[model samples]
Target: MNPKNPYKIALVLLSLFLFGCKDSASIPSEEDLNAREQTPQEESNQRTTGPIDYGYGPGLLPLGDEKISNEPKIGFIYSCDTQLNGGGAFKAGEWINESEGYWDPNKKIMVDGDISWANAQFTLETKGTTREIKGNGLPINHNTGTYPISTQDEAYLYDRNPNSIKEQKVVLSLPVQPTLAATPRCASGMVAIALNGIAIFNGLDAGGKDAVAHEIQDQCDGHPQKDGQYHYHNLSNCLEDTPRDTEHSALVGYALDGFGLYGKKGENGKILTNADLDECHGHTHEIKWEGSLKNMYHYHATEEYPYTIGCFKGNINSENLSQPENNEKPSMGPPPTQP
Candidate 1:
């Protein structure tokens, strides 16, 4: 890096071209080097790295049943103990027991261990010329207690008897084809959902504090709120990383407005920063869509502030998707103010 030694600079470039730094456990990927050299506004020839999924990526993957079933089944989950989920040893459309929530290693009792165990559905709503993908806000992941949630100064637990988790009628409707809006909208609570049917929330906690910064989350960086609804304030990195080329970003979920939500970095193992994103934390470029290449606008999560998304690039059906109980405003740990 010494300017006085031209050979040294040449050696550095040559080394990069031939081989990345030797000290790291892995070498820098080709795309990583290129993205670093270019600024976000500099017009990227860079494309998303993955084949188009038959369904959508992450949140909306597997369009519908790849094939229809003739089995005589009225409902999915069979009993009060059964839960519908596509994560953690359960495949898509499978039901498993969700009674035991996370263990309190210290107290040795299950926390947030509650479920309404009810039927949920997603249907297309068409009235006049409008279309939407509508369904309840209930998650298949059993709502677990995150009571005694720790904050900067104190930990607060909700009154379990009065505040309990229940099936929420949340409707989601996004255009089969999405269009970018002229302005970005704030991502409040319950901004989206994951493929597993879990809730995806905004980056801010009830107090506008960085939720990811202070909340004590389980392995997926998710926890239940006072009402026992489990959700994420960040990408959570919970989904198992599927295989793709080195420069590819994994689809994690979707924003309520129907935009694709991608993982924390570019294919090259580089940590994507806010600098690489717009005010809504996204960009437009070539992406793999339904097994083919399509140029489109999508959001990418960063490791920094507003880790998931800063705003929405497309119009959102807030009333349809926002958690009804959340309208009362969530807590910021005893400060007690409406958001």
Candidate 2:
């Protein structure tokens, strides 16, 4: 059951009536069915929005039955202060020319036709010298002998030096103080606008699903779980936007059916790293993936490079939550062309 349609009020009413008339063995009359059917508006109120868990939103929202906050932390760290064209544009990271083996920001578009680009623009407004950090930490996977690498160019010991891979720590740390610029600096590959870290996208058809996997896995090398949804980090290279400047980044929204950032194991447990991006709550929306590494609030996107996905430092103030600076124009970069 899609948790959104949780328990029905009608069922509750039926139980109450049955208990009240314990001796009555006869089936409910038409009146009971009519009364039950009249609660559609009540059900609508309860079922309109999917389950939201507080864990996913850092205690800001409810995490439902799934622990969506326990996945590996992967993102980028950016400083607001580096803009091009007089804070009018953000620096853009060069797209990779290839599509095999390693992950890169060059291929963040869906190949299929269902999920197209939505002209939603995002900007970074600062109150003071604010610093934004985004990163994902993956647990040590001993079975695959896989580890994390901060950059795409970093050579994994397994591919180059097998013996060295074993000696090295199972976890690889990639740290950077991203410069905030109007250029597309931080974002690369597909980026989902997750609140605190919970994905909030809609549904997708089969082709759209393939397109999402191809874009995410192909560009970021995220491993596909048994359900075929890809989950992995891509290259997030970004520059910072300074006090008087801003930055931008591109994003792709994938339309998936019952898709989320993670799924569930049993009824009450979270499916950490499952084949389903189920933690995103199957709300039949679009998952917006970033094309750059810059941090911005989960809701904004930009065609400019070096994006500030959410709030930026150096500009923080009392209006931190209410007001943000997004001075860039809404323009879309071309979808993945080739390589």
Candidate 3:
């Protein structure tokens, strides 16, 4: 063979090798790229950093682990002040009928707003042995906080209550003279009806947490549930007859057991505390009963946890009871949004 011919052969071999390399170096396909395992850093980079979902509505998330007690909380006791979600306290202030347009998580005080209902009604009467309480469940005495908290309002960030304050057909016939049961029974759902015609739920919210502390309320300390039934978790300061210093608190409402629920004062006009009462948040004493003072077992409202009835001191008339929309069990999730 000629020398130049040999050189040409070598060049051809080199060219073939280069061409094979070029073919093997082709770019990977989209599927192959996606199939590869991602590194830790890359995986993190691909994830979105946003607010966590705690199975709660806007602003309804507790600041810490929720303080939920198992059912049969009849004798279970806890402090209301400590159950707060670190959100803030609802303080007494001028009514905020309009939205404020911003939410502040660090806000230490929660302001009140007005929720108007045109046909507010309530009545209390005693006929024979039955004390008939009737009303369209609306706060007839004072204005309530706006419901379905408007996105325009700052409270929306904390509580997006989607229900409106609709009137409920409430007619509860309780015994005029309730007698104590052999054993106190656990109470839930609509435990009582405020004198103003609003439903008074037990101290627990739907999630079994301290309702008054975790949930936001109107200036009147009232909010509506899923059924549009206006209700309270604690005694509303807006009640018709709240007695002052040295006077026994007036009869603000009655428990499902048909026992009168008095204000936060005991005899001799002393503001009561959990220490002052029994596990049911009351004590047997001579209170103004049906127009005359008589000694009986009655519940009392306090500025503490389990603010109202802790347990039923008397036999409850389940048939006459107006159950909450979610009456069977405490709701595990947040309330649904308004339609």
Q: Which candidate leads in TM-score?
A: 3
Which 10 consecutive positions of candidate 2 have the poorest summed lDDT? Answer: 236-245
Q: What is the lDDT of residue 234 in candidate 1?
A: 63
RMSD of each: 20.3, 22.9, 31.1
| Residues 1-339 of candidate 1: C-alpha lDDT, one tens digit per residue | 000000011222223222111112233233333332211111122212223222323211111111111221111101111111111111111111113211111111112322233454333443443444444544332223343333221223221122334455555666646678776664555766654356777655443334444343443455655565666666643342323335446555667777778766554545565556776777777666433466788877654445566666787666545553222123332333435
lDDT of every predicted structure (CA atoms): 0.43, 0.20, 0.55
Candidate 3 wrongly placed segments (more than 4 Å): 1-112, 240-243, 325-339
- Candidate 2: C-alpha lDDT: 0.20
- How well does candidate 3 match the true structure, expressed as C-alpha RMSD? 31.1
Selected candidate, larger lDDT, 2 vs 3: 3
TM-score of every prediction relative to native: 0.53, 0.18, 0.66
lDDT of candidate 2 over 1-339, digit per residue (tens): 011211122333333222111122233332442233212112222211113232322112111111112222112212122221211101111222222212122223211111111221121122233322121212111011122211131221111111111111111111112222232222112233221111212111111111111222111122222222223221111101111111111122111110112111211222212122122211122222221222222222211111112122112122212211212221123222334
lDDT of 1: 0.43
At residue 19, what lDDT does model 3 achieve? Answer: 11
